[model samples]
Target: MKVIRARSAGFCWGVERAIEIAREYATQGKRPVFTDGPLIHNSQMMERLEAEGIREVGDYLSQTSLEFGLTDAEKQRAVMVVRAHGISPERRGYLKQLGMKFRDATCPDVGSIAGRIKLHARKGYTTVIFGDPKHPEVIGLMGYTEGRGHVISTEKDIDFLPPLEDKICMVSQSTMFTFDFERLAQYLRQRYPGALVFNTICGATRERQSDVLVLAKQGAEAIVVIGGRHSANTVKLAALVEKQKLPCYHVETAAELDLEQLGQYKVIGVTAGASTPGFLIDEACEKLAST
Candidate 1:
């Protein structure tokens, strides 16, 4: 069996920045701090953070040691973090209403698109967001404006879009495909002229797609996309591989790989999510090779 790892696999710029910020804060004695989410999609990273004094808080209203859990006393002492996935603007206001101290660790690229939405909206352009509606990133972006905005998973989702009397501003989640988002943007323009599109998909997403596409093109018998099942970006990469008709497995860990499946392929290409760690990739490689 031959195992080839995608050159552009694993942690992206945003994940790196978020983790670094958490570590920096922890080092400064910010013990019992609460993150809005796991900080990233990877369980290993979450466990590591828990060991370092950072507590995980999936929801602000949860019973965890977050701002929500903090009595009036702890709210004045402990910190509340907006994770990389970010919280909605409404959520931010609600947090404020709770009188919590928050440190926004949203990626700069993500923040830029949200800022631009405000700018373009001021210029009379309606905004269209490309992503799963349930995604935290999308939820956060949507909170940025109370104006007219539409969310779409495909161009067909916009087939019934209202006539553009003014203008259109289309943006995407940072983990979406550049090519797909552009194609969707072009479709919207064909249907509605005077529409503006911003490719908010991050540079890291493009690299991961490009690397996996190259692996698929090289005739790899099977591909393993490693990431959390809930991770939208990682799932998107897996979908990209599937378009090639190659056998692909989207697994969170090496333990998830089936030995029976390995028998069907000789060349296996491995790729991982932005939140995935290097060691997870290495473990998958070793397990896949051994099988």
Candidate 2:
């Protein structure tokens, strides 16, 4: 069996930046470093950071509680790092009100989407987000809409949108599937002729998905996608592989790889989500090579 790994697999620029910032703070040993949430979706990465003395605090929308067993004084004194996904403006304001010292590690691409929503909303345009509504990125985006935004995951959801007298501005989560976003954009164009659509899916996501497509076309009998189960981008890659009618397995780490099943394939493609760490991808590749 041969193992072919996607060149674009593993951490993207944003995730890399976030991790770098967290590590810098952790290394400085300053003020009990804490992230607003998991720095990234990968559990292994999170555990590694925890072992290094960096910890995750509060949810995106809520305040930091005694969840980390930190006393009020500790919570107040600790430096908070906002996760890559970003947080709602309301939450930012609330944090400010509490006088918490925090650093914003929001990805530039995601931050741009929020800025676009705010810009359009100020001009009386309703923002339409194409992605999972419950996602932290989308939630932060909705905060910029000034209550004039709607979240829809599909073209069908577009039908349920409230009637809009003004123009509509449509944007998508940075990690969403590009094809899905385009399909929905096409539908919105036909339904609302004046709707403005922005392809907010980041270039890294496009590259990762494109790499998987190339692997499928290259006749890989099976594909292994590595990433956290909760990672939206990683799940999409696995789904894309399955859509190509090839056997695909989504695993969080090498331990989850089904060696017995994968041994049957002559050629196996390996790819990972944007949030995946390089070491995890290396482990999967090593395991496959050994088998």
Candidate 3:
């Protein structure tokens, strides 16, 4: 079997920087250092970090606990690391209020999006974000609005607003696919001619998605999408591959791929999330090729 890997698979610039920062923090051998969530969306990557003594905090899906800040026993000693997804301005301020050593590992792309959101909010434009309402990046973006904006998770939610009257600014979570954002933005502009739209989808995501299709078109028989299940961008990429009627497995590690499933394909395509590391993709591809 010939294994084909997406050239875009693996760590993005932001993810690489975040991991490097975390490694530096881990080398310090700090106590009870915690990421607000899994620093990235890949469970395999998170396990590797945990094995290195870096602990994970709240569940990435629906976990929002300020316990890291409130634990009296761990208060002054614990080092809290903000994940790459970043946190709300309020959450960051609260984390600081606890008087604990803190490490910020928010991806630069996300920070830039948050800055744009903040800028729009400060300019008196009621912000509207495109993404899951509960997602950390969306939550962080919403925080800049200071309770003045709304989050539209799906296209149907677009119609929920009344006839547009207030100055509105529309931006997206950094990790969302460009197609989805574009479709929604196009519709919103048609519905309300004055809606200000900002495209915040990271360039890496755009390139990765475009390249995944290219790999599939090159006759990849089976596809391996390596990333945490809760990773929106990863899931979307896998879904896109599936739409091409190719067999795709969304997994965090190579162990999850059954020998039988892999054996069924002659050309296996590999892809990953922005937060995924190159080592993980390489391991999976090596296993597939060896089989």
Candidate topping lDDT: 2
Per-residue C-alpha lDDT of model 3 across residues 1-291, encoded as one tens digit per residue: 788888888888877877777777676566656777778877778888888767877744545675644567666767778877888887888777767788888888889888887887788887878988888888777888856778886767888965556578899988787888899988888777788999988888888899888887888887889887888888888988888898888988888888786898888888988777888888888888899
> Candidate 2 residues 139-185, lDDT tens each?
88899998998999977899988888658999999988888899999
TM-score of each: 0.90, 0.94, 0.90
Higher-TM-score candidate of 1 and 2? 2
Considering lDDT, which of the candidate structures 2 and 3 is the better prediction for this target?
A: 2
lDDT of each: 0.81, 0.88, 0.81
- Which pairs clash in the backbone of model 1? none
Separately for all candidates shown, the number of backbone clashes (residues 3 or more apart, or on different chains) is 0, 0, 0
In terms of TM-score, how similar is model 3 to the real structure?
0.90
**Candidate of highest TM-score:** 2
* TM-score, candidate number 2: 0.94
RMSD of 2: 1.9
